[model samples]
Target: MNVSEYLLKRLKEWGLHRVYGYPGDGIGGIDLALQKAVDRGDLEYVQVRHEEMAAFMASAHAKFTGQPGLCIATSGPGAIHLLNGLYDAKMDHVGVVAIMGQQASTCIGANYQQEVDLQSLCKDLANDYVVTVSNPYQIRHAIDRAVRIARDKHVPTVVIIPNDVQIKPFKEAPNAHGFTHTGIGETTFAHVTDVAGLHEAARILNEGERVAILAGAGALNATEALLTVAETLGAGIAKALLGKAAVPDHYPFVTGSMGLLGTKPSWDMMKECDTLLMVGSAFPYSEFLPDPGKAKGVQIDIEPANMSLRYPMDVCLQGDSASVLKALLPLLKPKSNRKWRKKIENNVASWWQLLESRAMQEATPLNPQRVFWELSPRLPDNAIITADSGSVANWYARDLKFRAGMKGSLSGGLASLGAGTPYAISAKMAYPERTVIACMGDGAMQMNGINEMITISKYWKNWSNPRLIVLVLNNEDLNQVTWEERAQSGAGKTEVTQSIPDFPFAKYAELLGLRGIFVNTPDRLGAAWDEALNADRPVILEAKTDPNVPPLPPHITLAQAKAFMTSLIDEPERASTMVNSARQVLASFLPRRRD
Candidate 1:
């Protein structure tokens, strides 16, 4: 067998069945081998429109499947295109293996075309491991180490294969001075917190009058344990954006996402709490958390380096979130006074009501919040949701309610704009029987979503349950940055830089032979969602939303208020912006009027 064939066979042995990539001449050997692997039913290849989308799909595959996702790319430009998506995986701490092609080995140092130093390019993304195979025997150990390191470290790893070496005959490393042998197996982690550390954590949690729990992406698998612990302590739980699915939003004391896009109950709970229990999350914004020394903190994390990085914890336990919480449960005493939990539940109920009122407020055509608000109740069970970063994320974070058995994620750490479509596609690929939805702004759709529709057209017929839905908020503006300029930077919206050309997203989907539904009014949103969810094939549900409606923070500070007022002096849409902003702020205090 050739080296390229051996690599595919070895990946099959590692139990990886899928690969996402785009082909190029530099990687011709592997491209040829992929057909043979597919013929043998050993591996399936998904051809994406761009190498960057391939990397994003791989990252999403890892997030959805709990396995190391694999992506392949050709030399120079193709390899460079994988950087943004790979960085997204690195920042979110997901397992991914990127195989990149390089120029022929003999052409090294000759300045051959497409000969760039890939090792330096991938250094930061694959900090722990990045290797290039120079010999046929080196391929074995290189592939083994890349998969193992990525899976164990939960970070992206790189394996570079030269074009010349990829076609050479495979050979086992013999018993020689310079040869190394490797075996394939899964690494088991025995991660449990010590008894003393558990006791200390329990002690702090037991002493507090009011307790608040914060969870992140790392806590996704610890839902049952998290719920139990929150019940035992009578604590309210707050999720970071990436941990939207860590616990069900229907719980009485489960406050939704926390930070700029957070809910008011989360802000109130953190501000009033005396004890903080943070699990499997390093939610970067310290300002959103309690003031230092106001609340005693206890943290649990699998990575030793992230134990107390976010907050000054009294006891830092390094272990898996579920196991640590289970061990600490025996030591924790159940709180009999339900006062704290009751207060939290009341706040949460009020917050939800306020959100509904805001979503129902009038806009030019439709309020973006109403789109997500209407879809929240109509979501299918066991559905997977993905969102792009923009003003759309404001509605996604605050309005959509996630129930148990549902999965959701976004570009959390990197906060990239073009990930929603690829992520939803990957989710559908991984779970064909379950429905998948992608929520995007017009900016993200134009950036990458429009091209990826062809990918959907290619693969939708192969899926068992073809219920993939793409929702586009067509506001014709880069809404998030425009609001940031007004609210945070004290500058008016610059139409030259923020305005984006409008496109008929639903019409484009229909042209691709998929279902399309467009809604310009709030009254039609619920029916549009029902139609999209029940469609026989994939559908694009586009909503024409107002761009002037402000995305208000849970708590607006005096400085932010001053900046927003200053911005209105030169703001192009000052009148509409002022009217909408006032309507949103007043909606919180007044109850919704019957239509």
Candidate 2:
């Protein structure tokens, strides 16, 4: 077998069956071997339209499956295009191994075509491990170390193989001092909880009258434990954007998402809570957290570096979230006074009501908030949801309520655009029987989602359930950044830069032989969602939404309010913008009705 074939065999032994990538002559040998692996039913190669999308798919695959995702790319430009998505994986702390082809070793130093200093380019992207294979004997160690480091450290790793080296005869390292030998064996890290640390954390939580909990992606696996601890302490849980699915939003004391796009209930809970228990989340916003001296903090995280990084903690319990919480549970005392819990539930109830009121308000065509609101109740069980970075994320964070068994994620730390479609596609590929939905804005759709629709068309026929839905908010504007400029910089929306070309997203899907559903009115949103959910094939559900609707923050600062008024001085769309913003603000004060 050739070196490329041996690499595939090694990956199969490592339990990785899928590789997301595109083809090129630089990596022709690996492509041929991939076909052999496919024919033998040893692997499945997902060919994405762009190499970047391939990397995004790999990242998403890891997030959903908890396995080391694999992506292969040809040299130079192909390697460069994978950076954005690889960085996404790196920042989010997912296991991904990127195999990049390089020019032949003989021609690499001679500056042959597609010959770039890949090691230098990938130094930061895969900081934990990056190696270029020069000899066929090194393939074993290269693949072994890359996958091991990626999976164990939760970081992206890179393995570069020269084009000529890929076709070389496979060789195992000799049992000699000069050559290094490696074996395929997975290392499992034990979760060891410190007894003193757990006792201190429990004491702080037990002593507090009003306790608040912040959950992030790290707490996803510890949902039941998190819920139990919150119940014991009478704490309200606030999820970071990355931890939206860490706890079911249907819980009474669960305050939706926290940050600029957070709900008011979360903001209020953070402000009032006297003690804080942060679990496996490094939520960046300090303003959204309680005042420094007001709350005694306790944090649980596996990484020592992440402990006390966001907020100063009195007790830092370093271990797996579930393990630490389980150990600490026995030492904690359950609170009898339920008044604090009652207030939190009330806040959450009123917040949901306000969101519905805002979503139901009239707009020129349709409100973007209403689109997500309409789908919240219609979401299928165990559905996987993805959102692209833009104004769409605002609605995604607040409007949708995730239940148990549902998996949802986006580009968290990277927060890059063009990830929604690829993430959803990856989710469906990994769990073909589960439903998947991708929410995106016009800007993100134009950026990469459109090209990936062809990808969906290519693979949808093979899915067991065939229920992927790509929902686009056709607002004709880069609404998020435009609003950011207005709210943060006190500048009016720059029409030339913010205004995007209008496209018939639904019609485009129809042309691709996929189902298309269009909604331009609030009344039709629920029906359109129903049709999309029950469609025969994959679907593109497009909503002709208004760009003027404001994505208000939980707590609007005095400066932000002044900045909005200042931007209105010369804002071209001031009339409609002001009207919509006023309506959203007024919705918060609307009377709450008992459901």
Alpha-carbon lDDT, every model? 0.93, 0.93
Clashes of each: 0, 0
> For every model shown, what is its TM-score relative to the native structure?
0.99, 0.99
Model 1 RMSD to the real structure? 1.0
lDDT of 1 by residue, 519-539 (tens): 998889999999999999999
Backbone clashes in model 1, listed as residue pairs: none
Residue-level lDDT of model 2, residues 156-241, one tens digit each, is 99999999999999998989987997878868768677787777787888899999999999999999999999999999999999
Lowest-sum lDDT 10-residue window in model 2: 586-595
Candidate 1 clashes: the total is 0
Model 2 lDDT, full chain set: 0.93
